[model samples]
Target: MTIETETGSPEAPPKTRLHVDEPLAAGATVGLDHERAHYLRHVLRLDRGDRVALFNGRDGEWSARIDGFGKGWCSLAVDRQRRPQAPEPDLWLLFAPIKRTRIDFVAEKAAELGASVVWPVLTRHTDVARVNVDRLRANAIEAAEQCERLTVPDLREPAKLDQVTRDWSSDRTILLCAEAGPVKPIAAAVAGLKPGPVAILTGPEGGFAKDELDGLLKLPFVVPVGLGPRILRADTAALAALACWQALAGDWATGGADARPPFRSQEPG
Candidate 1:
């Protein structure tokens, strides 16, 4: 079918979500590029007139319909807004890139945990010299879609750890996951920190070099913290620190400490 009318006059809107960079409003039209068009037409097998939700991270969520479509091209007619736009936490995950899959996991988890930015850092012990920022951004977008996040986290290009530290915003606190020196519990380290403009630094699997560690410790804005008595993998440390910050000082704590379960506990199928 080229176009589909709402079934029974009350068909449920499509659940597909796409992050666009344009302002969204009723009656506005949006064009899908070839890749996105392929996903809509061939991958999802959607016909003209099918509905799709759109979010630009600024104008909130909107319900849009496939008004026109063909091979590698599609246009959507914005219909109505659904959810209102909300501010994302200003937390940033600045970590040394690990293996390809593990670094990807860090990006996805960071997005899901509401990190406003994901930065790739190169440390003395970093094994990987470069990272695919596109892949990281795609992972962040997919995570945002799955988790009902209105916006995707900003992914940064790879840069040397030393330079990143030198240019970091001094007004923001940088929590460094260190195994040595005066270390506080991750929770205690983040205590009393507000939701805006904070970043966490996790090192590579081999840990930071002595010089690098000293450099970070000497940064006036850096706070060295430890996950626990036990050491965690780089990816694990990033996710754990994010969750700790959220539960301790981030938005997740707003549920009043006695909120419902973290997530549904149903057994896997």
Candidate 2:
């Protein structure tokens, strides 16, 4: 088996990128599971010798060629590294779980928007009793694949808001999206935040209870921030806060290491 060299070319990258748990290195053989194998063979109709991209959280993205395929299984030969592993924003998103579809949307968008962690928080006003962490992880994985993210957001088990707050680390600031009470506008608040580990917390559709809000405000790490005068849905608030943070203080801002043009402009010639 021959190992290819990295070219750092301006051409477009492979469209099919998959996240796997195995290590990625030159000449390494990666085997796809049944679901992914089915996706490539039946759904994508890709054949042997075709190319795809693979990445694990530890290794950077790599180009790989289909070496062989069969029923419910496929193997790829790692060709070369494309992009080096780069630093990403250490931002977490904690929110009160909502309905199924909307929560799925939150998981997907959070991964795309550079959230390092996605945790479901149970609040007094939260209506949803159960959270499907596996489903959230799947959505995060799919979103990371589509957005060219090197790693998917870590999906945490559902925990009560009070318990999470009690055990929270003081070094990481929490920007709580408050619907009422004295709060600084999101834009203004994020602008003053120092670069470090941070998290965005959003309430459920019904909003946080008065006692819950009061409890959070008392915490030294919590900073209440308002979206606007108008009320936003649970999912909307979470994504909005995430986007604002990324734009203002996260990796989306100017002078970041991973700054680049949109994916379409880099298409292969």
Candidate 3:
């Protein structure tokens, strides 16, 4: 199944609805969880027998009928599955969280800009010790649904910067955004890099310590880059890097053809 965008339109055509939790299966009895039920019943004001489009990260999207509503459960009977869409590239965005509101903005934009994964790293200059994974997931879900994306970017549990880089893969390029120092332009750094997998690392609010910078720079595949002459906030740096990546190496230039890459499995069964 292929998720193709209508040709000849600069804007993304609207998708009727988006389902992320579970793929709609034909003749399969699927129940909406409590939160979803509230959203379907109250927020959306959707009633029984209404039609909604659903996509469960793995399955191609499908049209579903609201089977019934009673108690706390809302049932849906999936009918036909739409053509599957390509997932995002094997690109990941690893950065420290900014303030609460700005962090939320980053997650949302990352989803729209087509990041394969989002990693929240705790660096020496990080503002928050911990992050709300659930909130970030919600933001990603909404972004995917609204952007006509068939697959949602995976939001990994927050980890310390040191721990994440300890086992970093040599095949994947790591684009590190340095705020105060001169570095290669993002385009130059990404040029001709292998397309298999990549990551963008941005510093926190106050920026990285000299020691932290040295640690990252010592890594075999880390490529430090500058956003521009002016300083940007943590959130701005993240989104700018993502936009540059997508425009240069992502499917954004190809319409929706490159939007969906192969989906990444969460864990081994």
Candidate 4:
């Protein structure tokens, strides 16, 4: 690690990632707003002509040079493609909201662990009844930028659990972290699934109501899975389930030129 100030706390220079909302191409010029300009200029202490990374989700990551700066904006000259646009695999996380911090945890971890979409659903036993979609979206963006992910997970409006279950896609498998009943080991369940779309369901700490559990279990596409003998917090269960699925059937299971993932989380907490 690079020394922060020799005598100061240890810190390396940040990766200099900026998520632009415009179409990016080689040799294109992109504008940065005041807030981002402030971040790059003051927070990151970047100077003119310094190199930075930029991505717009649709376009691939690019290495850019700070072209110029003004009162409220900064211009960047796109240099070259850093990483090609490769979206996360089709894995959706449908979770019930818990406490504020834990829900934030779910959003951050879901993006870091490769959730293509994050859907907040309201289950019968859920304690927290509301969600701040914008906050969740910001958390997703920060996580994506920090983790070097090409795209941020799509954040959806909160929906009722029953309605979500009713309109569920027939092609995608639903892996539910069950509150009770005969539960298949999560690892085994994920490992057995053929390559396809997936949606993992994790409810609030209070767990789903009897009727909700019963209805979900009855669905032909639903598969009740267990984490372990001990019950986990709502957020913990979601993380465990996501990691298990990725290792068994998702990108974590891919092998080619390199079995390692292209992205890495370099930002500190």
Candidate 5:
């Protein structure tokens, strides 16, 4: 994708970035084709000679100057790599879909929160039976581009709980936010676990089924945890779990949360 920078004017233009599916390299003539060109030229009112930033999941972010635009084609001269790929944790978000909009929100937020992967789990009580992987991927790409994230979170295809859980590794602790009553708060559970690779799982609108919860609980690596006294929506629970994990064992504490340009996080307490 290519973006148009503002013309020579007194006002500072809004910062715009575009996500392209190609490797970005400094000092290269990057070309935009078809849909992206139209969006930049027509929708965004970007003209030839405008400046915009381009970033792919690899090669980081780069500055580019638009040379021309027309006939479903846009050209730009890549200047420099504006941002470098930063370190991101192995944190993953494994959640059951709630509804259309809510599920979309969860996918976008997971990308913004620095989750390396977003795994949509088909739980016993999950309401949504279908997921458009392409739609989720688009949402993630947009989120990463806007948020200046060099690395886009991988939105894995939705998998059944049993099938996915059976291959679980004991090395990575999986925190399942079971809505069941006895589970301890996530903060407490996280504090007790040895820090390394971590992932959080949130259930659907009706919560996890007893048999499903029982199976997950029986896993040696799965830690059944609670979010607090209040029951959260699937999306909210997923984001809250991410924040809590980042705060405790992730990167929110180190102030790395805002230090890196593309990704990475702050220190955890």
Candidate 6:
């Protein structure tokens, strides 16, 4: 039986991509742990000499051949580089924690949308008390692997809204998705600003308390933008704001079909 990805398409056998911490260079050997070893050996049923892609965030991406495998581990020899490391848009997503499933969806989609950082901000209306940073990181890693991103978004621990805003960098602008306020249309707001370091902040499902919204407004870097007449859920608002930013002022404006070269498969020698 052939395994299919979420898209319902047959997964490419040789194009299995793994994010690893070890440096990838020609002739360098990398080892996988038991979990990954079991995945490749039993789940994928891959054998020796099968080629796989590896990325270490800093090393771009490399093709490697399975050199050895056992019950608990697998080793691969690095081949040549497939794609060089390239810069991504310095966009951040800051949101209040929501329910478990939605928060997970947010992390996954944020990675696919090219958020440079993912941060949880505790607001007065935020119902969720704790955030599993490990789980968020795992979701991000998996998303990066599936989406072919060179790097995973930097995940930050949960912080209070006041603390986050107080320590926020003046250089980076925050596009606050405000449900009620004096706001500019998202597209218009994005069009007015130059493409630079930016973050999108979405409130909780219950919305930010009045005082919280007021505090954010006083910040010079915070620019509240309106999505439209209709109110959106916390997750919807975050993603919609991000999509607008990317389409107007982020990498999406400049990236297209020819943005990068096609992936070329390498054969083991």
Instruction: Give the per-residue lDDT of model 2 (tens digit) for 1-269.
Output: 12233464444445488999999999899999999999998898888987788889889888899999999899999877777787889999999999999999999999999999999999998999789999999999999988888888999999999999999999999999999988999999988887679999999999999999999999989999999988999999999999999988887787654453233334343
lDDT of 2 at 75: 99
How do the residues 78-119 of candidate 1 rate in per-residue lDDT, one tens digit apiece? 977766787667888999999998988999999999899899
Q: In model 6, where do residues sit more than 4 Å from their true spots?
A: 1-13, 260-269
Model 3, poorest ten-residue lDDT window? 6-15
lDDT per model, in order?
0.84, 0.88, 0.78, 0.84, 0.80, 0.88
Question: How does candidate 2 fare on TM-score?
Answer: 0.92
Is candidate 4 or 6 superior in TM-score?
6
lDDT: worst 10-residue window of model 1 = 256-265
* TM-score of candidate 5 against the unseen true structure: 0.87
Residue ranges of candidate 3 with Cα displaced over 4 Å: 1-16, 257-269
TM-score of 6: 0.91
- Model 4: weakest 10-residue lDDT segment is 256-265
Q: Report the number of the highest-TM-score candidate.
A: 2
Model 4 lDDT per residue over 1-269, tens place: 35332235543433478788988998899999898898888887788877778888898887788889877889999866766787568999999998999999999999999999999999988888579999999999899888777888999999999999889878899999986997899988887787789999999898989888989999989989999999899999999999999888888877632622233345554
lDDT of 5 by residue, 1-269 (tens): 22232332332222368887777776788788798888888888887667778877778777788888879899988766666766767899999877889888998999888788999999888878799989998898889877777788988999998988888787988889888946887878988998689889988899889888888888889988888888788888999999888887776768763454322123331
Each model's TM-score, in the order given?
Answer: 0.88, 0.92, 0.85, 0.88, 0.87, 0.91
Per-residue alpha-carbon lDDT of model 6 for 129-215, expressed as tens digits?
799999999999899888888888999999998998888889999999999989999999998886579999999999989989998
Residue 235 lDDT in candidate 1? 95
Q: In model 5, where is the ten-residue run with the lowest total lDDT? A: 5-14
Q: Model 2 residue 217 lDDT?
A: 95
